[model samples]
Target: MTVTADRFDDALRAGPRVVLQTPEGVPLVMTLASVGERAYAFTIDCLFAAIGLLALLFLSLLTQFAGSSLFGAVFVLAFFLLRNGWFLAHELRSGRTPGKRRAALRVVDARGGPLEPLAVVVRNLTREVEVFVPLVLLANPDFVLDQGPGLVRAVGVVWVAGFALVPFFDKKRRRIGDLLAGTLVVREPRHALQADLVAGAADGEDSRGEPAFEPAQLAHYGVYELQVLEKVLREEPTRSLVLDAVAEKVMRRIGWTGDPREFGGARPFLAAFYRAQRARLEHDLALGRARQSKTAATERGSRPSTMHRNSQ
Candidate 1:
């Protein structure tokens, strides 16, 4: 089903997808990272940090590290950087930490674009206010409870508690950092697309069957063409302008000048072409004629016949 721009709502509950329009008026769908996935990524990141701290301590003790004075200074610096710099550097560079990459997740612009460096900084800074500062206090209960000022301690407790629980209230699973930064944690899209672009053609023709593409027609494309076509299909808006554009290009490539109306819609026509092209490539592969791209197919001297045409 097509999600129209007019009725574009995140409240659909159909899935964790955020469907928005890009600056170029393209309908973009971003799959939000699931809560479980985010949690798993977080746990892994914490594990790495802990392991790093332990390794530092082990090294310092092994060499005595010029006594406690030098070791204490170095330990504090390492702890601070590990707690803060790790997230900042990774996000600023690639928007994905080691954990996020492992979990197939990355941070992105909530409005559907590239992650900004400022946004990364803001989000990670907010993270300190939300979690790490409170954690530091909690780790030292003797000071917070017995010696620290009651009001400051209470406020710190409340600040961290509220931020911690707020994401549970949000459907998007956005924390204080995400809200401030206008960023989203999204699962990465896979390169290979499913073959469900057109349903009827995959099984039986409903009433209008698209014309079968001959081996010569299929030979106009290869694996690269299949990938591009899939991307077009995935990102096509409710208006379906891209669909027509790509369908026209495919028709010209295969030299099919038959009635466009006969194909029913551009989706089915493209789906038919995709299926045929994929099948042709697979068949060629079985015979050791592996065509990796359209350029490779061309290098093999494929002779497409425009003289012969198929009509439904």
Candidate 2:
């Protein structure tokens, strides 16, 4: 449960990253640490950018109506600048992946910390040139004329083509900008806590406050049952099959006659069992730690008494 950052990096570097069910029966997968937070932040930024662009468009029209073409052009330029700036900001703030953050996605440096802002900015901003610029020129006739004659157009074409091929040459699936920036995208494991053990119990008020399973009850279950349940939760096998299989296995192991189908839902039931197990393990660990502390305190308290007795 207290895996160090170095051990995590070593695991990743060892080979293709995988989520292994720990002995305690929890699934572990590498995902962005704060993916949800980053996604929420990114969404807010996109919304603000959209609002600003709309406001700027309205202002640009008003300026054009007032007979200042220069102001209108500047407004248009600002529109593009702010749009690209928003994207860069989102990428830096949200890391590489877009959308709902999951436990299985993470962006970290080789040292296993959040990436520096500058590196994120550089890699993302370069995306504008590598992916966006050519598409813009090809899609819009105006960009081609703005650059003047055929030679500029030809140069644009070549630049676009060359940069498009950068991903192939790079070792880490990095493009040109990513190569220049000292960064690599990797996944981080989701945090596993003892509290997660009671994930599914009852939703109603009576069951709400009740803990999943007592420590003694969990200790009674066989090791294989624990292992299978861990696999079901971590790998998330097909909902029904995994659920039924786990229910049947655990019931047989514990000699319970309750129908597996009566559990209502497979995923929820299995998840709850795993959580109960985790809670039990945590409870035991806490008790052990407390006992050790008490023993140490008793020894310290008796040290002087022992010395006095020896002198006598």
Candidate 3:
């Protein structure tokens, strides 16, 4: 088969993506974060850290009369803490730092599982060797030696540059920290919910109002599941088997004890469940509770569980 020019253009235009699995045996295509995006995020994080450092510097000047030894020690300790703790605290609390959040990026398990705190620590701490050490060498070559060796400084610089370039070489665009911690930085897909079926149903709808679903029952699923349901509902009505399977899963989740047949059919049952689930999700969204998926880590999260799809 001859490849068309359009196909070649499409291939060239596509960015790097990795395929992960959902618990329900579905395939999820995750887009790797671009170099430009990562750099943007890193710059933002550094800016925030710099602001804190500047504040501490001002405080040190104010307390200069308190003796250089006391405040000098405090300055060093605070510098180290602010420089690293800023990243550790934010990442441990939520996989994404303020920078990652603003960039719409996240760190996920490379092996397709929940991101562990240990992994977060490992990745963030690598900044010491990967970034900090290199920066010091560049700025002050004699950091290690009284008269920093020219060869040694050059070697350090090259090593750091190599680390910086690792992502360009890796198929997944994983850098040193990500490779060591088995994590990946993925960009969240910007997916908007389709036009409100629940609201539209208010006028001509008949199947969704019969069975009342409780908040607790409706809370079993999240935006991810809701989108999947929406995808199904938009297809041709003849795909009854697909609807039946999806409906069964929803019933199991909501602990629907009533018969599926009694609800009329898969279409009606799914419609009712959809209405309840949408209302539940909307309420949560309004309250600033973002549940990307059922298994998504909570602050313990994802959008980039937008890393947490449906899986292990």
On TM-score, the leading prediction is: 3
Misplaced by over 4 Å in model 3 are 1-14, 59-69, 144-149, 196-312
Clashes in model 1: which pairs?
none
Error of 2 at 241 (Å): 8.8
* Cα lDDT tens digits for candidate 3, 236-269: 2834787777777777767888876776777777
When summed lDDT is taken over every stretch of 10 residues in candidate 1, the lowest stretch is: 303-312
For candidate 2, give the lDDT. Answer: 0.52
Error of 1 at 292 (Å): 35
Model 1 TM: 0.54
Candidate 2: tens digits of C-alpha lDDT, residues 69-141: 7766876777777767765655577764433233234444433345788877776678677766766767884
Arranged by lDDT, best first: 3, 1, 2
Clashes of each: 0, 9, 7
Residue 147 in model 3: lDDT: 57
Q: Report the Cα lDDT for residue 298, model 2.
A: 45
State the displacement of the C-alpha of residue 255, model 2, in Å, after optimal TM-score superposition.
7.7
lDDT, candidate 3, residue 26?
66
Model 3 lDDT at residue 270: 81
